[model samples]
Target: MVPAIESVGIGRLATCLREAGLLLLLALSVTVAAWLIRPEKMSLRAETAFYELELDAPLIAVADALVLYDTGSHLFLDTRTAGPGSFVTIPGALPVRVTTFDDDLYENRDFLYPEDPVVLFGDGNLPAVSDVAALLLERGFEEIMIMGGDLEAWRRTGGPLADHQAGEHE
Candidate 1:
């Protein structure tokens, strides 16, 4: 009887171990597939990849932008000053209004940190984003990125848009 009981316990233990091993392998396989099929490589320009997110554009170093804003050191601007202009924005995204963009960035140089990430956004495939990136580079902004997709993608993703047009305080 003792031997029979011992054999049953061993069988159960072996079954549990097999199940655990299978689960681990399955998880590992899924992780590897996710890594391999990840979307287009991160681009530094506004021209590459299908426009998807404004609040979290892959083309933009969104992580850096968060760092800058969290520390009160950086500015996110809608670069769609030409054509029809931007229609939405990432939630809580502060405007680099024409007045400030002109005076603050150009004349006053407010919040100037060469290392800070300056993110510029605009409409799909617009040139303004790249222009801002270049200008910031010239201004010694060590990190600059253009959100590949403009405000449309932002709005579609339920990203917060400023209430400027609605007369609500941003």
Candidate 2:
């Protein structure tokens, strides 16, 4: 009787070990297959060159942006997020958030045109502005500009600010 009980215990241990080994092997196989089947459209060198160009892109001063605004030949994109009760933006400026920018927004005639000059500005946040500009460049926007200053500079230059929340009033 004692021998039979010992044999049963050993049999259960062996079965558990075999199951665990098979599971590990299956997981490893899946991982390797996924790696081998991954897409390869964007190469490392191409990605690096894109970032280099984005970093070295030309910057437009607040003065120049204002002039363009007055001329009505350029479109202004305000990438600033509203804080508390304040959502001030340049007059006629379209609001754009980097994280939420959609391709469909560009399809709207009122929002974007590929050939039109576009000035992208944030609340003095370089990284945020650069990210949005990079996305625009990737989407093949012809002429893109980054504002050299922040919202304060826009106000200092007497650039009109309209409350973003004020729909018809704007």
Candidate 3:
């Protein structure tokens, strides 16, 4: 009789478990259906527009950069990390911190001309230069040039350094 009662309890437990599982499955299916039919969806056109933005910036030798620098019309953007180490940037160049790129760009938007040449340089940070160049291109900057040399090269090429050093690198 005890065994018979135990089997009956086990059957009830199995039925509860099966029903619970079915309920959970139903809930999950409803959640997924709602997500699939959500009103707001990501726009593929925006992604395509972003892909269409030209990310390849032309390279400009240090010598050519020097010439453009002398013209005083071209905008020189220093995208090097600010702080420490013997990093010297071109005098009068706009300092754009790689970490705060968007804010720096917005702050200096008045100085930016979409049609003017924008020279970008960094202290052996090629990615930073390329990223900044891409952002400039996205902002409608026509001529974005990544300086082919490092800050030391710029310093050697008679490119005057700013009066204050950025800081020291650790």
- State every prediction's TM-score relative to the real structure: 0.47, 0.59, 0.58
User: What tens digits encode model 2's per-residue C-alpha lDDT throughout 1-170?
Assistant: 45654555888999989999999999999977776775422233544433454442467878778888888888888766554454778877776667666733443456577777889888876677878778777777868888877888878876888776522123
- Which candidate leads in lDDT? 3
Q: Which stretches of candidate 3 lie over 4 Å from their true place?
A: 1-55, 84-87, 165-170
Q: Candidate 2, which segments miss by more than 4 Å at Cα?
A: 1-56, 83-86, 103-109, 166-170
Who is ahead in lDDT, 1 or 2? 2
Tens-digit lDDT track of model 3 for 40-158:
33333554433444436877778779899898868888887676644445776776766877877777767766887888888865666888787777778888888877878777776
Q: Name the lDDT value of residue 55 in candidate 3.
A: 36
Flag regions of model 1 displaced more than 4 Å.
Answer: 1-58, 61-74, 82-113, 165-170
Which of 1 and 3 is the better model by TM-score?
A: 3
lDDT of 2 at 55: 46
- Cα lDDT of candidate 1 equals 0.54
State how far residue 113 of model 2 sits from its true place (Å). 1.7
* Candidate 1 colliding pairs: 91-160, 122-150
Decoy 3 TM-score against native: 0.58
| lDDT measured at residue 96 in model 3 versus the true structure, 0 to 100 | 70
Specify the poorest-scoring 10-residue window by lDDT in model 3.
41-50
Tell me the number of clashing residue pairs for each predicted model: 2, 0, 5
Model 1 lDDT, residue 52, Cα: 42
**Predicted structure 2: lDDT:** 0.71
